[model samples]
Target: MAAEAVPAPRREAWERRTTVPLVVLGVVFIVAYTIYVLAPWIPRGPGSLLFFALLAAWVVFVVDVIVRISLTPRGGRWAFVRTHPIDVLSAIVPLFRAFRVLALLRNVPYLQRRSGAAVRANIIIYGSTYAIVFVYFIALATLQAERNAPGATITTFGDAIWWAIVTIATVGYGDMYPVTAEGRFYAVFLMVGGVAIVGTASATIISYIGEKVSEVHARHGNSGSAASDQEKGPIIEPPGRAIQDAIDEAGAVDDEHGG
Candidate 1:
């Protein structure tokens, strides 16, 4: 008797339900950060809302990260933590003071396989991240430089935010030029960094477009080849096989009749 074959172990399916909350949390973070950065335009009462939203987002992000880590493969958890200590820190770090933005990089692997969607989503994410960081740094530098200067314009958080936006966008209308030496230095840095950021954004958009085009071309080529093969019909059997079989049957019939 033949020996029975052992069945292969089944691989686990990717659990979308487990990851859905994490993805939602990431989206919430993105949205809350956007609102936080734009809080200058909101009224004081509404600005508090932005702060509360940020707090909520941070909490959600921490919970999501913990859930994700829990769901990760046992060996993968250690490897990820070893390589991404920042991610671990972001989860536990103090609110509004930690380098939690660095946690965005952790999503790269999950997004990478999605190709077109990944490219577009990354462009948006990185663009937002760049904007948020640029605003924070510029505001910090501007406030530090101009806060004590006589007759300096950037007196409040809103003014500083506005200045940061203008500087980082390179639309410096000179309506709020930095008067102090440190402010001037920051301005120069912002100008250069702004240009680099814009260039990087353009490159990302172009690369995404190129990836989309390549995907379309690949799909078209595959479909065309499949259609062409289908039109050509099956090549395994000769065209004359049916007729040959019929002729052989006829001959057999005649031989039987004559016999």
Candidate 2:
């Protein structure tokens, strides 16, 4: 008897849903974290909101990875695993400080294709995504380091958020510092990370400027072509007036010779 036919593998529905939620969660987390870090004067409830929002972000990230792996083309999984070994560990990574947040970086391509208002919207969305990830990681590191230190004022979530902002901005305001050894180590890491973030922002800005310049150049070129065509009118070359004049002169010469 013939073996039962194997059913074709189907793409996961969850994968399709992942993109929107990932983007939304990234934005929410970034905003919450930013407010938590930058505005310590704000009450504790907002910090709690930021914490829960980060948790939700991790859940979304996990779902997105599972969906992506499940929907990945057959035989593509091994290639993906080989190329992105981090994806395998994404499931088990700690929600608070996971680097999996970088996975949402895929939206850059989509951001590049948009135009006018759409492009502006994408820029806002992309910026928020990066900001959220950056702030969340900074807050997590700062909190872990600053907690339980002698005379450490950064014990509260708000203080931690403030430290994160200062750290990421590379302000290094000596007012709040990590006293514990672990906190100091984390601070070193944060400073390095801060430099990288700043560099990335600069690069992104340059790329956006280049894109705008190219667009302007294309528009100018098209308009110049259109204007030149309008000014020159239709391109009909009248029969050669110079050649006719030469022919008439030759005939007069011949008539004089005959006379």
Candidate 3:
């Protein structure tokens, strides 16, 4: 592989430096590709422009793979590609371009740090944002693929969004559906991502609840210890109290004897 010719250090440096720009490129590609898919009625010149944009994005994706392979510890390109099938498919299958959003995972921790949010709150916010974005993109893809297809029930963006929400929630209301295989694949992808998000959210909630319970238990334990100390009696201990009572009895007997 030509990429294998590149020095490992250089490849890693390039990846580190270009990671942000690559993410930006991926977003741009997604937008351009969406427009291309949805607006088939557009003129040839604009369509050509969108096509080139997609091609450029594909090139970047390919470069990323090669660089990753070059930097691989021992496995080389083929092994790396074999392990990450999604990466291989992302560019070759243009429909998988949306899969690039998985890159956002790298940024999630950074975002959480910048926002200074608790883990649970951050997870909820991130999950909600991700879910919304995912649903919207899936809807757009579905709309583009299914809109002009024969016997398609999803002609409008509204219908596409509704279908996406329903499908992702595992609620299969049969009012709308994709006619094309490409669109159906997107739906499957959406469902899988949705399930993953649900699972993550569940874990986050459980962890947060556990933390709260632990805090409460710890707090109660401290209070119980304090209560036990208080129960040991006043400033003077039990023996001191007994000695004071005996002194008072002796004084009372002396008074009676003096009377």
Instruction: Please name the candidate that would achieve the greatest lDDT relative to the true structure.
Output: 3
**What lDDT tens digits, residue by residue, belong to model 2 across residues 166-235?**
8878886877778787677667766786787777777667777888899999998887777876686788
Model 3 RMSD, rounded to 1 decimal: 8.6
Per-residue CA lDDT of model 1 for 1-259, tens digit only, reads 1111222122112223434544455455655554544444664354576567657766765765576566565546655456556456556543222334434454568556666677667667766775686667567657756877998988666788888788778788777777888788777867887888788888887987888899899998887777876686776757599789889999999999999
TM-score against native, each model: 0.45, 0.48, 0.70
Candidate 1, residue 203: how far the Cα is off, in Å: 0.9
TM-score of 1: 0.45
Better of 2 and 3 by TM-score: 3
Q: What are the per-residue Cα lDDT tens digits for candidate 3 across 1-259? A: 6534434565568767877777788788878876775677664363487777777899988877776766675635565567578677776766556666556565555445643245556677667866887787789878988888989999988899899998888788888888899999898898898789879888987887888899899998887778865685666669889999999999999999999
List the pairs of residues colliding in candidate 3. none
Total clashes for model 3: 0
Of the candidates numbered 2 and 3, which has the greater lDDT value? 3
lDDT of 1: 0.64
Candidate 1: how many backbone clashes?
0
Steric clashes per prediction: 0, 2, 0
Kindly indicate the candidate among 1 and 3 with the higher lDDT. Answer: 3
Alpha-carbon runs more than 4 Å astray in model 2:
1-127, 151-153, 228-259
